[model samples]
Target: MGLFDRKIPFKYLLMGIIFLIVIVLVLTGIWMSYVNSSDNLRENAYRLRTMTESYIENSFQLIDAGLKLYDTAYNHDMQEAFAVVMAEYNGTGGDPSRMDLEALKTAIGGMDVYVINESCVIEYSTVPADRGLDFAVIYPDFCIYLHEIRNTSGFYPDRVVRDWSTGTLTKYSYMPTSDHHYILELGLQSEYFEGERKQPSYSVIVDEARAFNPYLEEVLLFQKQKRLIGNKTYVPTPEDHAMLDYILWENRTSQEVRDTGQERTVFWEVIDLRDPDYAADMSIFAKLTYNDALLSQELARLGVLHAFAGLLLLFFGALVVIMVSRELSRPIEQLVNDVNSVASGDLDHAIRPVSGYEFSSLAESIQVMVDRLKEQIRKCEINEKRFMDLVQFLPQGVFEADAEGNITYANRAAFDLFGYTQEDLERGMNILEALAPEDHTRAKETFMAVLQGKKTEGSEYSGVKKDGSTFPIIIYNTARMVKDGTITGS
Candidate 1:
């Protein structure tokens, strides 16, 4: 039989089936747990996004409020500074080279003021490096933005923007001269306005976000970001620039998964904080990062526990199979031993009682057959006694012999006819041995003719008596058969 079709012992079959069921359950449970772990990761990403986005949004909201409060005071201050510089310009016959730009810088909280001509070139500054710089070539977009602000008569403010050359946070303001001869500017920013701005700036808040949450790996607020942390400027990678561009172009929230030895989920958010008072784009960007190792470890631990539970179930199932198989084998073994006793001709051997009704009925049936055989044997003994008594008085010699020529039974008349005593008959004596040496072959032929139903009434052979004397005798015999049609003797 094929392996699948072969009959297995009850014990092993039961254990195999139970173990298969347990393994399937274990695998299914582990698979489901893994699926839920994926869901948990997404949920954690959302939760982290929700929790951190608020902190980011609130920081921007606070900055927006700070800008409004700072704008009113700073705008007024810039407008007045322009008027004073204009007075100085006219006072020196509009020769900016002769103006006391350093005196004006000290007069206004160490601010560095600049004078940009209509040609968009920095002509004069409190800082000597600001002189003779061409804004149109060095900062074309910023210059264009400043030119636009020059047409407006009111003070305009810009959001906190990073200084490219020095990697510093600088907020600038602009106002046009009534004569429109030059667009005035003022900023000396990194440590210049620290006392006036809001406490806990954007960089500070983002840097501290990781201290509160364990799953949070990193945080970045991209809205007018500070590449410079304290004095060090963080040079971003190409991937960082691409993500920033995607957020700016798509103007929507998005996410990405990345694996760098350790896996992480990055969530991005875009916030619009633009206002007419600002002279530049004011879109806000927030990125929240989370780790994945802890979740994987937890799921792996659950899988191990599931496998352990399956093993425990299989062990218990094996124990139950052994117990049940042993209980069933006892009755069957007893029935087999009873059948063996009957086969050995022990009709007197009793069938023992066994467990279960089926085994008990089988034992009773075997006992009945044994009892019937005993009755038949008793009847045969009685019949043999009557035959022996009848044959003892017969005038003719009567005997019984087997097919092997061994005389098995004989009467007194037969013993006298052969000149042998009952004691001699009790010993082994063949019918052929009772004949003379010359008559042995003829007597055997006549014996075969009798067994084959041939008429041998006149067939004569010389017999040898117990005293070694020879005599002529005629053999008379018939074939004997049992109930099964087997020849017993003649």
Candidate 2:
């Protein structure tokens, strides 16, 4: 509310309000920019996470497809073996022993195979010790999964299972005879396809991360128990290990920032690449660092620019206010000086035309007043001269005095009657001096009474000339006033 106080000028108040508005708007823009920057960072973190997940998932799918192709190839080869065994049984009346299971197993890229009868008993196997044994007794779950796939369709779709005896995960492909009396099983360890032999290299992950996000400053890959598997860094720092430790302990997938003591801000994003097949845990982390001071560099420049602009505005605004105030007050100041001059008896000191309609009308009014004053003074002088002539030719003497009873004017007849020179009248002569000493009291009373607006008829008084001669004289007393009817003197 003080902004609107009248003691402060209107232009100054308006400039202050405008400056405050500019400051508010600039601050609001800065706040909104920060908010939007934070939001964009969060979104970028999530999108990077998604991209990494997709890359791993796609790699796993490709490996699984490769395993499925091998399974299909093995299934077809085993079906051919079952058909050969049946044909040999029909022609030679014996089990199909001529079919080399070892060579067939080697050709099918498998380590073992087992042939089982309708009762789920192994009749032939690459390892002879497994013959005459119940296959379901050895690995019932695996046999069940095999039959489930065989029952479903010609192509097998089954996942790997852990073989408790060998401490290894194993995958199997199977085929059955058309009569459904015999089945062939081909077994291979899961590691043969998904272990170090075929898994994606750590370099692939690092390369892909670098390619996807150029902002990445470094990447660290770790196995379970904090074992460092791989790392790639554009700019290595000593604090990286500490930051990674914090991220692992917190188990947070979100991005976190750290102060690197080098006038830079660094952020980290961790991804847990967990898989059931692997015996240990794995993680992927990415680090990105940037100069935090750079964030405010532009804003600092903008602030300086705003300050400069505000200074420019203030300077121009003050200049304009001064000019306008002077323009408005000029005419009034001129009129005041002219009035002072006229009061000092310089009637010719007249007003000139002032700029603007209002000031022009005021100047015209003042000129009219001055003209009327001059005219009245002219008439007063004329009346005084005519009265003086009449008094000079009269038979009696005439004189005038101020309210204080000091003689101000005397006509020629008054001087002649009193026998005083004109010099004596100019030297402040009073009529009381011309009266005889004994008649002074009565004459003084008469003069005072008349000056106070009382009329007096002629009174006989003894008068004395400057030569000390006394004579009998009659005096008439009266009062006079100037124009406008204000009493001046008698």
Please report the candidate that would top TM-score against the real structure.
Answer: 1
Worst 10 residues of 2 by lDDT: 274-283
Which pairs clash (backbone N, Cα, C closer than 3 Å) in model 1? Answer: none
| Alpha-carbon lDDT of model 2 | 0.62
Q: Which lDDT tens digits does candidate 1 get at residues 394-419?
A: 99888888888889887888788878
In order, what is each prediction's RMSD in angstroms? 6.8, 11.8
lDDT minimum window of 10 residues, candidate 1: 224-233
Model 1 Cα RMSD, Å? 6.8
lDDT of 2 by residue, 79-168 (tens): 554454445334533344555677666665655677777667778887676678774775453456445544432433233433334434
Per-model CA lDDT versus the true structure: 0.70, 0.62
